[model samples]
Target: MALAGMLLVAMTAWFVPWALAHTDWGNWWLAIPFVGCNVFVACTALLLAFNNSKRSIPLRVEVARGHEPLVGVIVPTASEPVDMVMATVGSVIDQRWPEDRLRVVVSDDGYSDELQARVATLAAELPHGVVSYFRPPKRGSAERIGESKAGNLNAAIRLLSDANCEFVETRDADDLVADPEFLRLTVSHMMLDDRIGFVQTIKESKTSEGDPFNNNELLFYRGMMLSRNADHCAFPCGSGLVWRRAALREIGHFPVWNLVEDIHSGVLALRLGWRGLYVPIVGAFAQHAPEDVANYFKQRGTWAIDSIRLFAFDRFRHMPWRMRLHFIEQTAFYLLSLPIMVLLIIPMAGLAFGQFPIDAAPMDYAVHFTGFAVAMELTMLAFAADRPLGAFVRTRVFLIGMAPLYAASTIRAFWYGAKKKPIYIVTRKTDEHRVYVSMLKAHWFLIAMIVFVLVMSARRDDFLLDFDPGSIYWAIVGLTGLGAFVRLSWFGVDVKRNILSRLQLRSKPDSHVQSDT
Candidate 1:
């Protein structure tokens, strides 16, 4: 529905320029916003390119050995299924570090009695003194308070810190650690440098099947995560991140106010003059959004809200000169790109009323649009330096397709987040394939608009640019962009199609699965 509406708006936009051209509004108003957005995108791409060129830190030795700092892995989960939760716990227990030395703290943010029992079972099965479960005092629903991932995490930190755990690690219930040596590798670095208080590792995807629409979300995330190394100051990601307990204590602990604690904590760490390290080692893998588009938006909304807060609140200014610039550049890149996306829909909306604006002053629109296109190309080239040509090509299109959607959601999140009424909704995850069968009414309309553009471009032969090399290049680029929308549904259709039907999958007994708050 949302997509269909956007298409209609886009089609309507074709006529906006023509209509406006007839009037005396002049091209300056339209050109100004469009040009401003273009420059923002171009500047961001360049900064990211600069960040990706720096040095990567290596793991230190014997950091997890006896008598060393006791590293605790804190996992907070809500409503995740039994199997996946267990897989996460097992992964932590199975790490190469000494079990006796490393402690796994599972915080059951879920208020469900059944899930609590599962946590009990996992704790019992583990070796003596290796794993412990902490249940926050149930107030209202877990989701409303401690059940929320960030709140639950703060609860665990208070518990472990009291227990004298020197350092804390945070991971989501669904996340998998690909490298068993994850703790040893990362802890070694932190131990060696007291100044380096927080460390986050790059995330990778191992699963081939996912809900078709958002399967590749993780790939884009990974690409962005790897690109952070270029900035010297790394951003904090929820999973595969470790923080020093003392540092947390100094900052008054994780702020429970924000949906994304990792980001909040990262900015706080920098303010305190503590360095945050980005380790390129593949520490974790996890599932992407499988079935629900709403859930996908909600997840993205959380990040966007936090990002905006980070900048609007002047959180980055607390950092040193070099580190502060990176955060500012990164945040500006994100917010600026969003308005560009939202504005594109305006031109579309205009075309629906027979306003055929693009026809009135083709040359002017062409010039403005041409500049935007070049800015996009520069953005792609900025990231293309480190990416495979194939992946880079696909990501560019994906970024383009997501612009409008991202813009809309960011606005919605900001509005709700400002009121502090945005609910923390959990995403449903099953090891089954789900198809995105319904193109929103809006999406269908957008498709029609695209078709209309093609037809009009063809009928008005002059509208179709000459088939020169540059035209051919743009044609390929545009088609690849169209592919991004189709790719959104690729994972779930491919992997989880028959997963549930093939097996009589049983929900593990509460006593058998661990539930972390």
Candidate 2:
């Protein structure tokens, strides 16, 4: 019913406008995807207004008094820093749950000697059998399928099968469980509710005042998908999630077929008659946002690719109606990148060439589009969680910058759909201080095209000499998107401090070998 309502809104908004405004039948293919995306965004902007997810919800089910079940904690690491991993394990140990009831399995996928040694020493320093280091048996040096996170997790959980753990909680190597009583709350919520396969704790990144990266996900997790709370469909958001052991067994373990095991598991769990509860309360568990832009891209790219693949696989149609509504919006969210390029290019081509794509005058098109877009953006601002203006700008700039990555990822997903498998590289928790010019290759090509268009259009009398109102309007639109792209990918070309001595082929005049001689 919700899906029908959304489709109705989109068709009414788009088809009516197109019927009155469309110039050419050939252009429908060019324009529908772009306009359809705009309609979807407008719908989201409106839907956010009804967001009453801020109110706390009481759990419907709770464990019987004194029925504390043993929880097997799995900490999966992939060459992560030993100190950070240790800190995460230490935080788990500090939980108020009985020390004997909690078993920590450090799934060491990285196979680093230092990490193995450190965990052993740390284990000895603590209670006997409280924490154990698990080094997965590597079938080959060349990392193959099942050697990734999903495989390590499957192995780790299997080791706990003998221990008869009723509950299993996954904690990333970089995340720290913030509250000592967090497990009690999460486990209780799943006690009587056999349908609920997992309880996902909301990520708390800005535990400190100085969160420069602003990894806090209040809007995305709490507000954006608040509607899903009613559906009991809050999917996993990386680490800090607890799963029912029986549910995992039913689903045949974590989704090993895809790169995005987190969301995949949630979707599969739901399909297998299992539901998930997402705790919206703030500060449930601590996991910082991406500290670097490159790492952020890697994280988003992996997510986007798998989302496209899943949607393309006809799995969306098979999902239950309650779970189906959100995936439409979710898949479209990632797919929006392609249509955005189409949206920008249509107007950009108009600016470059005097002939507009549609039959309507440029002014009419611009005015109508401006009114609709402004209304949508304003609605988004009204519901925005923080600094509305800054958030708006950040979002647009990010969308503009990520267009290339999204486009490439979409192509990459299709490229590997049937043939070679794509390797899932773990996102680095640490920041990437070094900048690579190669990363901006797509942006460079885009900028070059924009400059060429403007230069060529300047020489044409009809292009801008007569000042066509439509041309001028579209030029502004194109330039605004381009400006956002520039703002994001602008790595200044100043390498004076970074220049190697060998690149200059010169040595310091004061340099001497007196001591060696």
Candidate 3:
């Protein structure tokens, strides 16, 4: 599969463009970046498909080795419900690490009185001095979508520093530690080598048999993560990992770069001469994915904005060449959707008018591009979805639905990441229950374009004119995008109904059910 991916990339990226350079539609100036981005995207997909997801420590290595480090688990929150806050704190207290050695710092960026009261009440019930809660100094929440998680975490690091904690583990208010031995395993990696900056673990999510949202990321944890481990390019997953204290100090603590910090901070740590490890422990942490389509787009948009800004700004000069290449491939992976802009337009341009994207034989283009796409898609479906065709298809449809926002993110990153923070919202469970037209606002324009093209082509008898393979190929692709757009909006519409109907059915208030009980 890897060889096939490479061959296909070579053919489409280099061979095809060169072979077609003399053809009427051969536009090298336009094709270079368009095809280049696709190649970069394909390379990343290949990495995810072929790379290893697991790293291991020697079994004989000692834990509780008299030098068991006192670690701080920092849980940051931004106006989340108190119940959600406690679930994470409770998990920290439940860690198998010595109760006295692990400290819980609840850094509430929201400054909610309700959370403060609940956390204080819970602290009284737990072991003496085992839990701590505090609000970091108020700063505007404009950066990194809505709230700056990095800002909250950086402040907590100071507390850890004052206490002389050996290491710190970051967990979002909803990201709960699952594996009791998580600390023991991750700490072992950092301890074995002082130069190791952090150790990341796979975050496992438990889902029902038919998860409409396709929330599970077991594929990423097991596949791409293992690949990063092999390339020596591991980065923190923000929640499910442990960080070395000294390494954080050397890199000047968690960096507030682009829109997110975890990946970029790991990069910064690497550039500062620190290494990271990716452990294949799937049960290290259990976290929630976006419950519905709207939040999923929101989550991915923030990521896309951050990842692309790196290309505009960050030049990784200090990191090793191979490590830098691996990082570049992964970070630029989100920009894959930029090609969708062309996908929507080129076919319509050929069919609706006479302007064709490529003058080459349709069969020639299809042979190369289709082969590349199939090889890439099959790997993701087979490996990423754990052999479930339905899971893979559903996830991909949603990704296709995100084409507009993803493209916007890439183009707008310069303004958003450079001059100002984009007016954006991070993923929230609250968003799962509500419906907003704005969630799919960008999608509307693209959907209308697809419809307009089809209508115009049908009227002009251009739909099947002149044995045009390029027009036909684009029609199929455009139709697929149209379907995805309609399908994603249906999810939003469905959630809207679900919310309104549930609101009408609500004669009572929401009750907090304690999972512990």
TM-score per candidate, chains pooled: 0.76, 0.82, 0.82
Query: How do the residues 1-517 of candidate 2 rate in per-residue lDDT, one tens digit apiece?
Result: 2333344345447543753466554666545554565555555544444333233355644445467788999998888888888888888988767777888999898888988888899788777777899987673444433658887888788779998898999888888888667787788888767778988876776333544333564446645555566776777876778999999898887876778588888888877778878775442354445655577678888988888887776465556775676666667667667756665666556556555445665455655555555554455454454444555555655556677788889889888894455888888766555554567677666666666767787788775343444334434554565555554332333346557744555655535556654
Error of 2 at 19 (Å): 6.0
**Residues 1-517, model 3: lDDT tens digits:** 4555455455446544543462453544444544454555566665554443333333424357466788888888988878877888887788677787877899998899998888889888877766888888777634322247878888777777777888888887887778777788788877888888888877755444555555665445656666677667788766787888888888776776556788888888888878888877643444466656667667877878777776667866688876776666655556666766665565565556655545556556556556555666655565554436665666666556667778777888876656576664557755444444566765666666767877776777534444455445545665675566555444535666777888877855556655555
After superposition, the stretches of candidate 1 with alpha carbons farther than 4 Å from their true spots are 1-25, 53-68, 112-122, 125-127, 139-147, 209-232, 287-294, 336-339, 342-379, 417-421, 431-443, 461-483, 486-517
Per-residue lDDT of candidate 1, residues 1-517 (tens digit): 2232333234334433433444333444444554344445555555554544444444445454564567788877776776777788889888787776667877776655766676678778766756777776553655333336767777776667556777788988888877888888788777788888788887755444432344434433445554444444687877888888878878886766566677877888778888777776777777544344445545665666667766765467656666766776656545754754534433433332323323335555554455445544554564455555656655566555555455565676567554364566676675343554363334444445655644554555444442222222334443455445644543345445365645534543557667795
Model 2 worst lDDT run, 10 consecutive residues: 47-56
lDDT of candidate model 2 versus the reference: 0.67
Model 1: lDDT equals 0.60
| lDDT per model vs. reference | 0.60, 0.67, 0.68
Candidate 2 vs. true structure, TM-score:
0.82
lDDT (Cα, 0-100) at 93 in candidate 3 = 80
* Reference-based lDDT, residue 405, model 1: 55
* Model 3 spans with C-alpha error above 4 angstroms: 13-15, 25-67, 140-147, 205-209, 283-288, 361-387, 417-419, 423-426, 432-438, 441-448, 451-465, 492-517
Q: Report the Cα lDDT for residue 325, model 3.
A: 67
